[model samples]
Target chain A: MKAALGVMALAAALVLIGKAERPETGWSFRLPPGFPRPRVPADNPMSSAKVELGRRLFYDVRLSGNGTQSCASCHVQSRAFTDGLANAVGSTGEIHRRSSMSLTNIGYASHLTWANPLVDGLEAQALAPMFGDAPTELGLESAAQLEARLAGDKTLQGLAQEAFGAGGLTLDRVLKALAAFERTLISGRSPYDRYVGGEVSALSPEAQRGLELFFSERTECFHCHGGFNFTDAFGHEGAEPERKFHNNGLYDLGAGAYPKRDQGLIEHSGRPEDMGRFKAPTLRNIDVTAPYMHDGSLATLDAVIRHYEAGGRGGEANPRRDRFIRGFILTDEERSDLIAFLESLTDPEFLADPRFGAP
Target chain B: MRSLLLSLALTALPACRQDTSAASLSTHRLRFIATLDGAAANCKSLAAPPFRLRDARLFVSELRVIGPDGETPAAFVPDSRFQSVEVALLDFEDATEGCEGDSAEHTELVFEAPVSSVRAVTFTVGIPFALNHQNPALARAPLTAGAMHWGWRGGYKFVRIEAQRDGVEGRIHLGSTGCEGALHAITSCAHPNRGTVHLELDPATQQVALDLGAFFGSDKGGDKTDCMGEPADPSCHAGYRAIGAAGKEAARQSDSLAANTTNPAMGASAFTVIRRTP
Candidate 1:
């Protein structure tokens, strides 16, 4: 009897994922210097075991209803976790309205999605791509079908049992585990990150000058793209998540309006003032993530800089055009400097990390 | 050791809710039967454009049987996973005989309730703001069905109906909007975007007639068949009225979910309630 109890204890100590059991110190975070710890949900606490299991599920195509795509399908790590598509095409080849955003520093996003104000939890957000019907991503018709598919996979079934205790492969547990893995995606190893860490020699003099121009009143880029993660929409525990949405004069249909189908925040709020407003994504990997904006309308960083310089682009004087987006003039040298500064934010180690790669 | 692992599996799994409503005497069953034009409607008939409804699902909550003073109390199932104070999620798409992209069929939302102090019934047309943000996959009964989950930030579509008219596809997705806060909690919303439906019902009746004929009919003035939750949009007028909005312009608002206290002359629409019958 004593031997059986000892065996059970040993099994519990070394969870099925072959990782350390819940240690006395709990989940140890390896966040880079100067970054605060991210706040995780009470229900879905971060666990190394959960993260390990999630990595396997992330690469497995079987997670999709059609067994053709996974989370990694759209969020490729080499391109800073963005699929490098103008707009995301789903497992069934359905075209999504918006381009895939980088998941580099997703943990710090105060709000999830481009325009949605409601989806604040990563667990809840996972359901959209996995089950949403219209623009199908990882399409599963129903929960029962999902359960049956997971139950059939012997290896996954075993890992899920260890991660969620008795609740093997539930949609709740899957989402929680996926979120736990996503929270660990910290990227502060770029040259800019090193420069910010008291190593002024890390950035080229051109990049250093570009950094100055980025924050200068003339450029005014920092108004929306300020902070360690480089977006106004960032927060952690106790810090009230900065809720902001802006319409950078992206469009004007006759009377200060965006296209009817893709009206950004206005579609959710019904307030005309919110028309054409969208969430400002993290600039951590701006260089690699091409064809930018909520709809991927802007093709290059140079083009983006030019757009800001031109101001409204004669879009019928949109009523809700962001005050900060009012056009600024810049010389050719200044444009290159700004682009260099944005490029300095990339963390090469994060882009090529084998751990984030497929198992 | 093997037995211990099995026990863990049993505890974590959502316990199968066997109709076991037969276990007690005081408990009575509740069901939401759907019909259209006074008959079992055909959701698939791509005759023209808007006339063909490829699929449809509606989420109903906060069911209350009115009494002399206000809402009366009843013996709610304590073990039920989704049983809020006095709320339930009624699904109509579970009956997937003629639907597209769906396999599991739920004919009606059937549950157990203590049939006492019941008179008129009142419910909401969309998901309440408080319960709208939580992980729907973790919840039970209707929430577990999985078809209702829409976009993550968008949450569940309170009323989602899809159809193709003149080869032009139209869909209506209704739910709370302009809400803020984390997924676990929402601090506030500029527009909660939910409408309440009140019906003068008798206690003897067990089912409410859910007719969708008027909901599918074409509104000549409206631009599209869908009401995508925009305030003052031309599309929401017909839908806002059909679900119980009496006022033309003010009844169905895409911009504000706040009740119009200033305009007392305009009456609220009570469209979801077709009739109360046994």
Candidate 2:
């Protein structure tokens, strides 16, 4: 009896130590210099198996309602995971008011979408494109049909079970896998990134001058788009979720209200003050994600810069424009230089990496 | 030495087997349901008075009861997946059972404690401030699964009641007001604004029915369903009246039932009542 009790004590100690140990073993990620690890939910710990399964599901056209589109369809890896469309067309052929957001470095984002404050993590945000009925994207919220679609394929089912550990083909497991895979989409090997590190020579002389103007108080561009990720809204383990939203003077349809249908955060809050507020997406791979803003009304990056140059394009000078968005005159050389600095944010390696490509 | 250790281990094992207090335990599975106009509530009726419940989610915490053995707080019977000490969220809208939007048939708040000597049960309507602002990734079930959380700055919605009367949507979203703090943690809130409900009954043989009909005074399908934490707003009339009757509007203390007094919690008793089983 005594021997058994002693063994039990040792086993208990081992179990306790295991519980305290870091969940990230093969899940560990070495983020770029100054970049922090993204916060992983306690319930859904990061694992290689889960991410591997997610990568497969992300590329599988069968995951869609009609089996015609995958997440990779709208989010092409070569274009930095952006669809490069003025307005995102849903899998059901519904034209969305906004463009598809780039998935590059989305793991660090605290606020996931253009405006909906309720959507914070990648797990919940995936539900929108997957199941939203108003403008159905993938249209796979119904579990029975989704399971039936993936049922015959033994390989996909095997991967699902391994990722979820016994919950055979459930929505929760699907969501967790997708979230885990997205968290691994880290992009920090750009020219700007090298300059941020020790190598100041990574950037050209013109680009370096443009960088000063971008971060300088004169342009006031860094107010909303600051930090290493180039967005004020960021979150990591142990740190608070910086859920920041802003109206960058994109629309001014008189009375400070944006276009009726495209009035960003105000649609949820119903407050005039919150009219055109939307999440400022990270500029990690801004070159490919053109036709910007919440509504994707601005056709080109040059048009976007010019909009800011004139302060809140379209209609009269809106009252709801952000305080930092004061119209400034830029010379042709200065304008081209600003564009050059934005171009430096593109991570070519991330776009070409076969790891993120369709399986 | 081995024998001594074996005896000790056996003794401790039995003692540690039970997590709660070392008292006589009686497990009671409580069922919570709502009624409309003194009848069983239905949100799917399509006639002149459509009884179709579009959405209804209630968040109640700090549950305590005065039992035959005195008073003790009721701790939720923790499941293998999630557990909590003080708060309980009772969901009544399951999609199949006439509910339009939701899918879960989770209408009961289940909690266990030694309550054989119990005479009455008490609970609050909203989340406590201590746990409200904590990291959501770390919080369990009701805090996580439910759509109660209203972003970092705004905090959780105490009671999210959305119903359609004659195809019109009426919503009441109750939450903490004058809250100022960081995104993750709200350090302080001027008005906790939570409603307390304490009912006199025995769980072993009786049931409790909360009449929401009294709460929805004149549900004319108007936009009076939304309450943005304002006391004077017309949309909050039903909600304010219901919360007011549950406790002493002046004092948030569980003991302040305010049975005889005007519920100082909100204003008028709106449409609120506590029915007991014989």
The per-model lDDT (C-alpha) reads 0.66, 0.65
lDDT of 2 by residue, B169-219 (tens): 556666665454443545555455677666667665556565665446665
Q: Kindly list the per-residue Cα lDDT of model 2 for residues A1-359, writing each as its tens digit.
A: 35323433432332222122244666666565556677788878887788888898899887677788888888999888878888888876878778888888888788787876656778766656765433457655344456667777777678877767775755567778889899988898888777665477887767767776786667778788876677888776556776778888776666676775577776555567888899888887898887787767788878988888887754235778888888778898988888888898899989988778777
lDDT of 1 by residue, A1-359 (tens): 35323433432332221222233235766767657666677777776778877887788787788899999999999898897888999998988999998898898888888987777778778878888865778887777777777787777777777767876788777888888888888898899877766577888877877887787778778788877778888877546686789888878776777887688887766677898899999899889989898888899999999988888655337577888877888899988988998999999999998778888
lDDT of 1 by residue, B1-278 (tens): 32343234324434322123322213334445556556644443333344455666676664544544344323224324334333445544533433555534343433233233345665566665555655667666555636576555445667666666555556666565555554445555555456566666553454556565555455541335656644355665545555543242343333322432212213233243344454
Candidate 2 docking classification? incorrect
Fnat for every candidate: 0.75, 0.00
Per-model TM-score, in order, reads 0.78, 0.62
Residue B205 of model 2, lDDT score: 59
Model 1 segments more than 4 A misplaced: A1-27, A197-201, A237-239, A315-318, B1-39, B43-50, B61-98, B108-133, B150-155, B187-213, B220-223, B245-278
